[model samples]
Target: LAQEGQFRQRSSSCHCVPTSLSMAVRGLKAVALAACALAVAGKVQLRHSSHKAADSSLHVGSFVTPLESKHQLRVCNAFANSAAMDVFRGAESLTAETPMPYKSCRDFDAPLKSGDKLEFRLGDASSGTFSVADLPNNDAVLLLVIHRHDSVSGAVSFESHVFAALESAQVAVIDTY
Candidate 1:
Protein backbone atom coordinates (compact mmCIF):
# COMPACT_ATOMS: atom_id res chain seq x y z
CA LEU A 1 0.00 0.00 0.00
CA ALA A 2 2.78 2.42 0.92
CA GLN A 3 4.52 1.86 -2.47
CA GLU A 4 1.29 2.35 -4.37
CA GLY A 5 0.49 5.66 -2.60
CA GLN A 6 4.05 6.99 -3.41
CA PHE A 7 3.62 6.09 -7.09
CA ARG A 8 0.24 7.91 -7.26
CA GLN A 9 1.71 11.08 -5.67
CA ARG A 10 4.52 11.21 -8.24
CA SER A 11 2.09 10.85 -11.15
CA SER A 12 -0.10 13.73 -9.94
CA SER A 13 2.93 15.96 -9.38
CA CYS A 14 4.11 15.47 -13.02
CA HIS A 15 0.65 16.39 -14.39
CA CYS A 16 0.51 19.63 -12.36
CA VAL A 17 3.70 21.09 -14.00
CA PRO A 18 2.40 20.75 -17.60
CA THR A 19 -0.96 22.32 -16.66
CA SER A 20 0.86 25.29 -15.11
CA LEU A 21 3.10 25.69 -18.17
CA SER A 22 0.08 25.71 -20.50
CA MET A 23 -1.59 28.52 -18.50
CA ALA A 24 1.60 30.61 -18.60
CA VAL A 25 1.91 30.26 -22.38
CA ARG A 26 -1.72 31.31 -22.86
CA GLY A 27 -1.18 34.47 -20.76
CA LEU A 28 1.90 35.48 -22.75
CA LYS A 29 0.05 35.09 -26.05
CA ALA A 30 -2.76 37.32 -24.82
CA VAL A 31 -0.32 40.07 -23.86
CA ALA A 32 1.49 39.94 -27.24
CA LEU A 33 -1.79 40.22 -29.12
CA ALA A 34 -2.82 43.24 -27.08
CA ALA A 35 0.49 44.96 -27.78
CA CYS A 36 0.16 44.45 -31.53
CA ALA A 37 -3.33 45.92 -31.56
CA LEU A 38 -2.14 49.09 -29.79
CA ALA A 39 0.75 49.57 -32.23
CA VAL A 40 -1.47 49.31 -35.29
CA ALA A 41 -3.96 51.79 -33.83
CA GLY A 42 -1.20 54.31 -33.17
CA LYS A 43 0.07 54.14 -36.74
CA VAL A 44 -3.38 54.73 -38.12
CA GLN A 45 -3.86 57.79 -35.91
CA LEU A 46 -0.54 59.29 -37.03
CA ARG A 47 -1.45 59.01 -40.71
CA HIS A 48 -4.82 60.57 -40.09
CA SER A 49 -3.31 63.65 -38.44
CA SER A 50 -0.78 64.14 -41.25
CA HIS A 51 -3.48 64.07 -43.87
CA LYS A 52 -5.48 66.65 -41.95
CA ALA A 53 -2.58 69.10 -41.85
CA ALA A 54 -1.87 68.70 -45.57
CA ASP A 55 -5.43 69.60 -46.38
CA SER A 56 -5.08 73.02 -44.73
CA SER A 57 -1.68 74.11 -46.19
CA LEU A 58 -1.50 75.66 -49.64
CA HIS A 59 -0.18 73.64 -52.56
CA VAL A 60 1.97 75.96 -54.70
CA GLY A 61 2.10 73.26 -57.42
CA SER A 62 -1.64 73.07 -58.02
CA PHE A 63 -2.51 76.62 -59.09
CA VAL A 64 -1.48 78.23 -62.37
CA THR A 65 -2.17 81.66 -60.89
CA PRO A 66 -1.15 82.12 -57.29
CA LEU A 67 -3.60 84.94 -56.68
CA GLU A 68 -6.55 82.85 -57.77
CA SER A 69 -6.34 80.54 -54.73
CA LYS A 70 -7.32 81.22 -51.13
CA HIS A 71 -3.84 80.15 -50.02
CA GLN A 72 -2.24 83.26 -51.51
CA LEU A 73 -0.16 84.96 -48.79
CA ARG A 74 1.50 88.39 -48.62
CA VAL A 75 3.78 89.93 -46.00
CA CYS A 76 4.24 93.63 -45.61
CA ASN A 77 4.18 96.65 -43.31
CA ALA A 78 0.87 98.42 -43.08
CA PHE A 79 -0.71 101.81 -42.46
CA ALA A 80 -4.27 102.66 -41.20
CA ASN A 81 -5.49 99.22 -42.49
CA SER A 82 -5.15 99.66 -46.24
CA ALA A 83 -2.25 97.82 -47.92
CA ALA A 84 0.55 100.10 -49.05
CA MET A 85 3.21 98.14 -50.89
CA ASP A 86 6.83 99.29 -50.94
CA VAL A 87 8.58 96.26 -52.44
CA PHE A 88 6.44 94.71 -55.17
CA ARG A 89 7.32 91.44 -56.85
CA GLY A 90 6.37 90.11 -60.34
CA ALA A 91 4.68 93.48 -60.39
CA GLU A 92 5.90 96.93 -59.44
CA SER A 93 2.58 97.91 -57.87
CA LEU A 94 -0.73 96.54 -56.66
CA THR A 95 -4.39 97.36 -57.32
CA ALA A 96 -7.78 96.25 -56.00
CA GLU A 97 -8.49 94.73 -59.41
CA THR A 98 -5.16 92.82 -59.62
CA PRO A 99 -4.91 90.15 -56.94
CA MET A 100 -1.36 89.27 -55.83
CA PRO A 101 -0.21 86.19 -53.94
CA TYR A 102 1.69 87.10 -50.79
CA LYS A 103 1.77 87.14 -46.97
CA SER A 104 3.02 89.68 -44.44
CA CYS A 105 5.28 88.92 -41.51
CA ARG A 106 4.32 92.09 -39.67
CA ASP A 107 1.19 93.06 -37.78
CA PHE A 108 -2.07 92.44 -39.68
CA ASP A 109 -3.71 95.33 -37.83
CA ALA A 110 -2.19 97.73 -40.39
CA PRO A 111 -1.96 97.78 -44.19
CA LEU A 112 0.68 95.94 -46.30
CA LYS A 113 3.37 98.06 -47.85
CA SER A 114 6.47 96.75 -49.69
CA GLY A 115 8.82 99.72 -49.42
CA ASP A 116 11.75 97.55 -48.42
CA LYS A 117 13.54 95.35 -50.97
CA LEU A 118 12.38 91.93 -49.80
CA GLU A 119 14.22 88.84 -51.02
CA PHE A 120 11.52 86.69 -52.59
CA ARG A 121 11.31 83.56 -54.74
CA LEU A 122 8.89 80.84 -55.63
CA GLY A 123 9.00 77.65 -53.64
CA ASP A 124 10.91 74.57 -54.83
CA ALA A 125 8.11 73.56 -57.20
CA SER A 126 9.26 76.20 -59.65
CA SER A 127 10.91 74.78 -62.76
CA GLY A 128 11.77 77.98 -64.67
CA THR A 129 13.60 81.18 -64.01
CA PHE A 130 11.31 83.95 -62.76
CA SER A 131 12.25 87.50 -63.63
CA VAL A 132 10.96 90.67 -61.97
CA ALA A 133 10.77 93.36 -64.62
CA ASP A 134 9.13 96.68 -65.19
CA LEU A 135 6.20 97.32 -67.51
CA PRO A 136 6.17 100.85 -68.95
CA ASN A 137 2.40 101.05 -69.18
CA ASN A 138 1.67 99.78 -65.63
CA ASP A 139 3.50 101.63 -62.84
CA ALA A 140 1.10 100.48 -60.14
CA VAL A 141 2.52 96.96 -60.17
CA LEU A 142 5.70 95.31 -61.43
CA LEU A 143 5.43 92.71 -64.16
CA LEU A 144 6.71 89.32 -63.06
CA VAL A 145 7.38 86.97 -65.95
CA ILE A 146 8.42 83.34 -65.87
CA HIS A 147 10.81 82.23 -68.58
CA ARG A 148 11.42 78.65 -69.63
CA HIS A 149 15.10 79.45 -70.33
CA ASP A 150 16.48 77.56 -67.31
CA SER A 151 13.57 75.21 -66.82
CA VAL A 152 14.28 71.52 -66.26
CA SER A 153 12.07 68.92 -67.97
CA GLY A 154 8.93 69.73 -65.97
CA ALA A 155 9.12 73.02 -64.08
CA VAL A 156 7.10 76.22 -64.15
CA SER A 157 7.75 79.55 -62.52
CA PHE A 158 5.46 81.18 -59.95
CA GLU A 159 5.72 84.63 -58.40
CA SER A 160 4.70 86.36 -55.15
CA HIS A 161 4.40 90.07 -54.45
CA VAL A 162 5.69 91.79 -51.29
CA PHE A 163 4.48 95.24 -50.40
CA ALA A 164 4.57 96.67 -46.87
CA ALA A 165 7.81 96.66 -44.90
CA LEU A 166 9.38 99.73 -43.39
CA GLU A 167 12.65 97.85 -42.98
CA SER A 168 12.06 94.18 -43.77
CA ALA A 169 9.48 91.80 -45.30
CA GLN A 170 8.72 88.09 -45.19
CA VAL A 171 6.33 85.52 -46.68
CA ALA A 172 4.43 82.90 -44.70
CA VAL A 173 5.40 79.30 -45.46
CA ILE A 174 2.57 76.82 -45.80
CA ASP A 175 4.36 73.52 -46.22
CA THR A 176 7.67 71.74 -46.69
CA TYR A 177 8.68 68.42 -48.18
Candidate 2:
Protein backbone atom coordinates (compact mmCIF):
# COMPACT_ATOMS: atom_id res chain seq x y z
CA LEU A 1 0.00 0.00 0.00
CA ALA A 2 2.89 2.40 0.82
CA GLN A 3 4.66 1.75 -2.53
CA GLU A 4 1.42 2.28 -4.43
CA GLY A 5 0.85 5.66 -2.71
CA GLN A 6 4.41 6.82 -3.54
CA PHE A 7 4.00 5.86 -7.24
CA ARG A 8 0.68 7.71 -7.41
CA GLN A 9 2.19 10.86 -5.88
CA ARG A 10 5.07 10.90 -8.39
CA SER A 11 2.77 10.37 -11.35
CA SER A 12 0.46 13.19 -10.26
CA SER A 13 3.36 15.60 -9.82
CA CYS A 14 4.69 14.77 -13.33
CA HIS A 15 1.23 15.42 -14.82
CA CYS A 16 1.04 18.80 -13.08
CA VAL A 17 4.30 19.95 -14.71
CA PRO A 18 2.94 19.31 -18.22
CA THR A 19 -0.23 21.23 -17.42
CA SER A 20 1.79 24.22 -16.24
CA LEU A 21 3.98 24.13 -19.36
CA SER A 22 0.93 24.13 -21.65
CA MET A 23 -0.49 27.19 -19.94
CA ALA A 24 2.78 29.06 -20.32
CA VAL A 25 2.93 28.28 -24.06
CA ARG A 26 -0.64 29.49 -24.54
CA GLY A 27 0.14 32.78 -22.83
CA LEU A 28 3.14 33.38 -25.10
CA LYS A 29 1.04 32.70 -28.20
CA ALA A 30 -1.55 35.22 -27.09
CA VAL A 31 1.08 37.93 -26.60
CA ALA A 32 2.58 37.28 -30.03
CA LEU A 33 -0.85 37.49 -31.65
CA ALA A 34 -1.57 40.81 -29.99
CA ALA A 35 1.73 42.27 -31.23
CA CYS A 36 1.05 41.06 -34.77
CA ALA A 37 -2.37 42.70 -34.73
CA LEU A 38 -0.89 46.01 -33.70
CA ALA A 39 1.65 45.88 -36.53
CA VAL A 40 -0.98 45.04 -39.10
CA ALA A 41 -3.09 47.96 -37.93
CA GLY A 42 -0.07 50.32 -38.28
CA LYS A 43 -0.29 51.26 -34.60
CA VAL A 44 3.34 50.29 -33.96
CA GLN A 45 6.01 53.01 -34.20
CA LEU A 46 9.69 52.46 -35.05
CA ARG A 47 12.58 54.59 -33.87
CA HIS A 48 16.03 54.37 -35.45
CA SER A 49 19.27 56.30 -35.20
CA SER A 50 21.23 57.69 -38.16
CA HIS A 51 24.77 56.40 -37.79
CA LYS A 52 27.58 55.90 -40.32
CA ALA A 53 28.78 52.42 -41.15
CA ALA A 54 31.49 51.24 -38.76
CA ASP A 55 33.75 49.73 -41.39
CA SER A 56 34.66 52.34 -43.98
CA SER A 57 36.92 50.04 -46.00
CA LEU A 58 35.57 48.87 -49.33
CA HIS A 59 35.47 45.07 -49.57
CA VAL A 60 37.64 43.23 -52.12
CA GLY A 61 34.72 42.10 -54.29
CA SER A 62 32.59 45.24 -53.85
CA PHE A 63 32.87 48.00 -56.42
CA VAL A 64 32.65 51.71 -55.75
CA THR A 65 32.09 54.35 -58.43
CA PRO A 66 34.85 56.91 -58.48
CA LEU A 67 33.96 60.45 -57.50
CA GLU A 68 34.59 61.62 -61.05
CA SER A 69 32.31 58.92 -62.46
CA LYS A 70 28.51 58.98 -62.47
CA HIS A 71 26.88 58.55 -59.08
CA GLN A 72 23.62 56.92 -57.96
CA LEU A 73 21.62 57.68 -54.83
CA ARG A 74 20.43 54.94 -52.50
CA VAL A 75 17.68 55.85 -50.07
CA CYS A 76 16.67 53.83 -47.02
CA ASN A 77 13.19 54.58 -45.69
CA ALA A 78 13.38 54.33 -41.92
CA PHE A 79 10.31 56.47 -41.36
CA ALA A 80 7.71 54.54 -39.32
CA ASN A 81 4.74 56.87 -39.13
CA SER A 82 3.72 56.33 -42.73
CA ALA A 83 3.77 53.12 -44.77
CA ALA A 84 5.52 54.64 -47.81
CA MET A 85 7.53 57.60 -49.05
CA ASP A 86 7.71 59.75 -52.20
CA VAL A 87 10.99 61.09 -53.49
CA PHE A 88 11.03 64.28 -55.56
CA ARG A 89 13.67 66.16 -57.44
CA GLY A 90 12.08 69.56 -57.56
CA ALA A 91 8.64 69.03 -59.17
CA GLU A 92 9.42 65.57 -60.54
CA SER A 93 8.83 62.37 -58.54
CA LEU A 94 11.72 59.95 -58.74
CA THR A 95 9.67 56.98 -57.50
CA ALA A 96 7.32 57.26 -60.54
CA GLU A 97 4.41 58.38 -58.34
CA THR A 98 4.55 55.18 -56.26
CA PRO A 99 5.54 55.67 -52.62
CA MET A 100 8.50 53.67 -51.29
CA PRO A 101 7.47 51.54 -48.35
CA TYR A 102 8.84 51.95 -44.83
CA LYS A 103 12.01 49.98 -43.88
CA SER A 104 12.62 49.34 -47.57
CA CYS A 105 15.35 50.75 -49.77
CA ARG A 106 15.37 52.09 -53.33
CA ASP A 107 18.12 52.94 -55.76
CA PHE A 108 17.45 55.76 -58.21
CA ASP A 109 18.51 55.21 -61.80
CA ALA A 110 19.02 58.90 -62.36
CA PRO A 111 22.45 60.14 -61.44
CA LEU A 112 22.91 62.63 -58.59
CA LYS A 113 25.35 65.48 -59.01
CA SER A 114 26.61 68.20 -56.72
CA GLY A 115 24.27 71.13 -55.92
CA ASP A 116 21.20 68.98 -56.63
CA LYS A 117 18.21 69.07 -54.25
CA LEU A 118 16.21 66.08 -53.11
CA GLU A 119 12.84 66.24 -51.37
CA PHE A 120 11.47 63.41 -49.22
CA ARG A 121 7.71 63.24 -48.92
CA LEU A 122 5.55 61.01 -46.77
CA GLY A 123 2.16 60.65 -48.37
CA ASP A 124 1.17 64.21 -49.27
CA ALA A 125 3.37 65.90 -46.68
CA SER A 126 7.00 66.78 -47.18
CA SER A 127 9.19 65.16 -44.53
CA GLY A 128 12.63 66.68 -45.25
CA THR A 129 14.99 67.95 -47.92
CA PHE A 130 18.57 66.86 -48.67
CA SER A 131 21.28 68.33 -50.83
CA VAL A 132 23.76 66.35 -52.87
CA ALA A 133 26.54 68.57 -51.59
CA ASP A 134 25.95 67.20 -48.11
CA LEU A 135 27.61 63.93 -49.13
CA PRO A 136 31.29 63.31 -48.60
CA ASN A 137 33.85 63.11 -51.41
CA ASN A 138 33.87 59.30 -51.26
CA ASP A 139 33.13 57.09 -54.25
CA ALA A 140 29.61 55.94 -53.32
CA VAL A 141 26.83 57.57 -51.34
CA LEU A 142 23.95 56.21 -49.26
CA LEU A 143 21.14 58.29 -47.79
CA LEU A 144 19.74 57.10 -44.45
CA VAL A 145 16.44 58.60 -43.31
CA ILE A 146 15.89 58.97 -39.56
CA HIS A 147 12.66 60.15 -38.04
CA ARG A 148 11.21 61.34 -34.75
CA HIS A 149 7.53 61.31 -33.77
CA ASP A 150 6.14 63.68 -31.13
CA SER A 151 3.29 61.96 -29.32
CA VAL A 152 2.23 65.10 -27.45
CA SER A 153 1.81 67.36 -30.48
CA GLY A 154 1.17 64.60 -33.02
CA ALA A 155 3.98 65.77 -35.25
CA VAL A 156 6.68 63.91 -37.19
CA SER A 157 10.15 65.09 -38.22
CA PHE A 158 12.87 63.59 -40.40
CA GLU A 159 16.63 63.82 -40.80
CA SER A 160 18.99 62.30 -43.34
CA HIS A 161 22.65 61.26 -43.18
CA VAL A 162 25.09 60.54 -45.96
CA PHE A 163 27.33 57.46 -45.71
CA ALA A 164 30.02 57.33 -48.35
CA ALA A 165 32.90 54.97 -49.05
CA LEU A 166 36.09 55.48 -50.99
CA GLU A 167 37.23 53.18 -53.73
CA SER A 168 39.71 50.55 -52.63
CA ALA A 169 42.61 49.18 -54.65
CA GLN A 170 41.83 46.15 -56.79
CA VAL A 171 43.07 42.87 -55.34
CA ALA A 172 45.38 40.94 -57.65
CA VAL A 173 43.95 37.61 -58.75
CA ILE A 174 46.29 34.69 -58.16
CA ASP A 175 45.73 31.17 -59.52
CA THR A 176 46.16 28.53 -56.84
CA TYR A 177 45.72 24.76 -57.04
Which candidate ranks first by TM-score, i.e. highest?
Answer: 2
* Residue-level lDDT for 147 in candidate 1: 21
Q: Judge candidate 1 against the unseen true structure and give its global Cα lDDT, from 0 to 1.
A: 0.32
**Candidate 1, 1-177: lDDT as tens digits:** 000000011122233235666688699989977986677666656655666554755322222222321112223321111322232333442332332233333221222233322222233222222232321221122213222223333232333332222233322322211
What TM-score do all the candidates reach, one by one? Answer: 0.21, 0.45
Candidate with the greatest lDDT versus the true structure: 2
Report how far off residue 173 is in candidate 2 (Å): 31
RMSD (Å) per prediction: 31.8, 28.9
lDDT: worst 10-residue window of model 2: 1-10
Per-model lDDT:
0.32, 0.53
Q: Could you tell me the lDDT of residue 116 within candidate 1?
A: 26
List model 2 lDDT by residue over 1-177, tens digit each.
000000011122233235666689699989987876666444222211222367444333213333364445666666665558888877889987577887777887666665666777776777766655544443544444434345454334444333334233322111111
Off by over 4 Å in 2: 1-67, 136-138, 149-177
